[model samples]
Target: MSVQTFKPSVRVGNWNEDISLDEDLLKDFLEKREKGELLLQKSGRLKKCILQKVELSFSKDGFLHFGDVIMLLNPENSEESLSNPSPIYGNYTVSVNPDESALSSKTQLTAPCGISGISNVKPCARNVFIITSVDGSDYGEPLHYGQNFALRTRDGFMGHLYLTSDQKTFLKCCKKSHLQEVSLTDQPSYETCWQFVYLDPQLRMENEGVPVPANTKLLIVHSKTNRCLAVLRKYILWTFFGKECEVTAHTYLNGHKAEENENHWIIVTGNPSDDINTMFDRPKPPSEEMNENKCIVKPLQK
Candidate 1:
């Protein structure tokens, strides 16, 4: 990605009437600057100097920086509406919401509020990310266990990927073991814990009395009587009785369900540091170890 260059047009007038910079004002001011006759300063000390018809430059990452001039708006003025006519010549931060329309750059302006010269744009405290897993088997869709696909957000602020459909099918593929020893009459009791980590813009709980979210993925499996204590110790906290407990789960605060559970769990995150490396370090089995050699041990009867 490359950087964008913009030539800003300047205008000199009592721009306090409206917050917008019309085409006429922009053309007049820019044409003057080209001829080296544009005035940089105003006559009256109390007169407001506002920037109009300005073209903003952005970095490769879509972050806006740099400015030509700035003006301080009267914070006490109630008649001025900053939402409609954002005060020119000042720096402000913008927040991104999960809603698709919130990322639009063209109609970013909203109706004028009571405040003058202030922008309606507010800083975002946290970024919303979603992960959805699809169980292709249930829908007649084959699992692509070893293969994965990637996706991106409209604004380029977020991205993620999951196993290809065919790869999931490979997970279910099986081979017979060579062991001839006598079969154990009884299997140990099944008990394991699983963690469902995801983002919650409102940080609201999915169900009542549930500390985490609802329908969280059950990833861990344990043997009855605690025979497989090694795996149990690693993921013990995610279990309640003899089954996987639902910890923090996905609850898309924007009235959207951001989770998918097709055979495997699909994790989504907006944290700048969240990535494949971070997920790999978690409790889930490595992609390589998910081969046919793995066996599904049943829980022992109580």
Candidate 2:
């Protein structure tokens, strides 16, 4: 039996538009050059190229920006307000680095700060929150093994966490660990820096809402390993009942979703007298007194 392959039809309308590939366009340009319709360099290098801009009446859901032009594919019903959306209107720039030898290009998209759609956002450093696991342990100090070190949170020390110089990475006070024992230091160092980011915005929005609070159902991400800081529930049970449960409340460096309960954290800052539990609900707006750099880390109340 012979099988027939299906070919999708391209429909150009108010919502849809088709764009020609560079290869096809170049091929046509070369053909035109042979006919003396277009000029080419003496070395046959196509240095100067002009592409006709394609227009769309409505902006699609997954529209992509190439330089100043916005490319829409399988557009949705909704349309964008402006002809060219700037970074202020959630439109950002995409950079493409092409390698002639490799015949490949590396592309990167970047959005301005405070935009919701971008994932590479540097966390607001004005108020640094010392994240503590639900089990009452702070992400300890940095311990050097060789040339590099790891960030570990130990119980009983104030983990004053802050964004690194890059603003995308997290760092805390440094401490030296020998064998299984840990020792604290008075100063902070770059060795304690960590790459931490928020969980998927969609998932976070489903669980909570926009303008996510520090104490809500959120995941503290470890950027380098793509692991999450989770609590081991068994540890809590073992601590209280001496039931010999495994230590489950620890930073998850591997991609595992075993401990969800222990993963939640409470971010505390500001006045020492204020109730930590109510801090998330009644968050003090950024004011003169409660400036961004002046944050106080406190332990979670039992």
Candidate 3:
């Protein structure tokens, strides 16, 4: 039963006890009772947090400013948001898994939301990021086209965006995440630097030092490899964030040239306290996306 369903034997106004209960003790008991069945949410626990969903327009200066707490919205064409056989169920206690990658996490069963929608699940660290320079500079600067910058996770996970160069083929997918971990703050590495390729060459819209707009679609290229950031749906992994398309930096050679790859992404940002949410609507299956299926827990697709 939920704590809200419980009631004290003594009524709120009709209390007739001769020996009164200690106020402090009463408060402690109630607090513990509330937390007893709590399911910890890293992003949800934020004393203040904003959940930003995708939209064609934005309320912030349409142009994105540096040092913004941002989240990258994967392209819908990537099929990254499609729900698979398994879907996130009700309330869960997310826990760290020692066997998985040190940065990896998993969801432990706790409460059931009773709803069949993936929308109800709490977001993982994957949904939060920050845009900063390799050094501590550029906090309030506007981002320019094709300029070098570092993207870092903002949810306290603390990983920098970087290219994974240790693969067999130089052109591998980017798990470095939105190019993701390693601290540029400690020492700048070329692997973590990335450049934004404008969507249209004709307009050269923001090339001349204009800030990239929020909710604007553009390509993310790793500085070292020139490989664009992409999500390989075929490379889905069951992560702490549920089944998600694997992040990679590469241009496929199937038909078109490297530049033809679908690597467009949107950066959304805002402060939760300002009524702007850090939580955006995650991709959900078209049909009934409920806890009907079990979670496919794995570190990576491979």
Candidate 4:
């Protein structure tokens, strides 16, 4: 194991937008600055400006850092949608439901719909998210257990992730552990904060406050409800993302999540250079531990 240190990236653009400097806007802005039309006030590192694309934050060391731009990928499943032109399955990324196409515009405009307990709320907003520190901690901060963090969307209306009370009547068996829904809010309220629970509660004593490695199996517990973030084999005919699976949040009624792997998630973030569309097909590390060691103890019951 190597100590992977990720130096935070410099960000430009409006709030929550990790500007891809490769855009034409960067060239246009830089040319103006060089021509004396755009003046930059000198700062610690602003004596001279360079225009090149900096990578988005993805952790390299074994742990996921606070500022890493990550995707919450549920484990792969054999299920597929019956109606799609191509196969759509359950190796789904936890994403925000975006604006739908003309055929599906019934999916209302995609933006923060105020708070979570409302009757009408959808959790999935955008595909990608930035793991941010709850207290405005400096960039590249290591995310540790027992610490709170906020998940802010990257591609669209910037909002923090929150648990919703809406019943996804559209989903089958809507009363299961996946019963409760997840959505985004316009502000970072108590509902939007979350804590990471290592599937192996034994790891807690040693790894508390340590950086969590990428690809490790973990439970994302919603701070407000104490329910864990989960995605089932259940697929929804999404207006925008095709037949993507529903990303919901809830703990099991019996308190033992031992029944299924749907409640587990892996942070498959990579270096800015890694492929965004790729997925780790190996068995979920946490599930494997649970099976081999019979580990049902995240304070979880037998």
lDDT of each: 0.21, 0.26, 0.45, 0.53
- The local lDDT score (0 to 100) that residue 231 gets in candidate 3 is 49
Query: Any runs in candidate 4 off by more than 4 Å, and if so which?
Result: 1-56, 77-89, 99-110, 113-125, 155-178, 202-206, 253-259, 271-302
What TM-score would candidate 2 get against the native? Answer: 0.24
Candidate 3 per-residue lDDT, tens place, 1-302, comes to: 65665456545653635225567668767785576422343324321222333222223555665676565655343232344433321121111111122312233211110100112223334344456676455576777777788765443333333222322233432333333211223234676687777765544554645567665566777777776765444543454435544445665443433244346565655434444343233333454333211122334445
The candidate with the higher TM-score, 1 or 2, is 2
- The 10 consecutive residues of candidate 3 with the worst lDDT sum are 109-118
Stronger candidate by lDDT (2 vs 3): 3
What is the RMSD, in Å, between candidate 2 and the native fold over all Cα? Answer: 25.8
Superposed model 1: Cα runs more than 4 Å off = 1-127, 130-265, 269-302
Poorest 10 consecutive residues by lDDT, candidate 2: 111-120
Candidate 1 per-residue C-alpha lDDT over 1-302 given as tens digits, one digit per residue, 9 for 90 to 100: 97655433343345533435576688889886685444332211111211112121112232111120111111111233344443332221111112222223122222110011122221111111111222222321221211111111112222121101111133321112111111111111111111223233133344222322111221111112211101111111211112221111111122364322211221211112333222212354443333221233444558
| Best candidate, TM-score | 4
C-alpha lDDT of candidate 4 relative to the true structure: 0.53
Segments in model 3 whose C-alpha atoms lie over 4 Å from true places: 1-59, 78-124, 135-137, 155-187, 204-208, 252-261, 271-302
* lDDT measured at residue 265 in model 4 versus the true structure, 0 to 100: 69
Ranking by TM-score: 4, 3, 2, 1
Provide TM-scores for the models: 0.15, 0.24, 0.50, 0.55
- Put down candidate 2 lDDT per residue, 106-143, tens digits, no spaces: 12111111100111111121112232222222333221
The candidate scoring highest on lDDT is 4
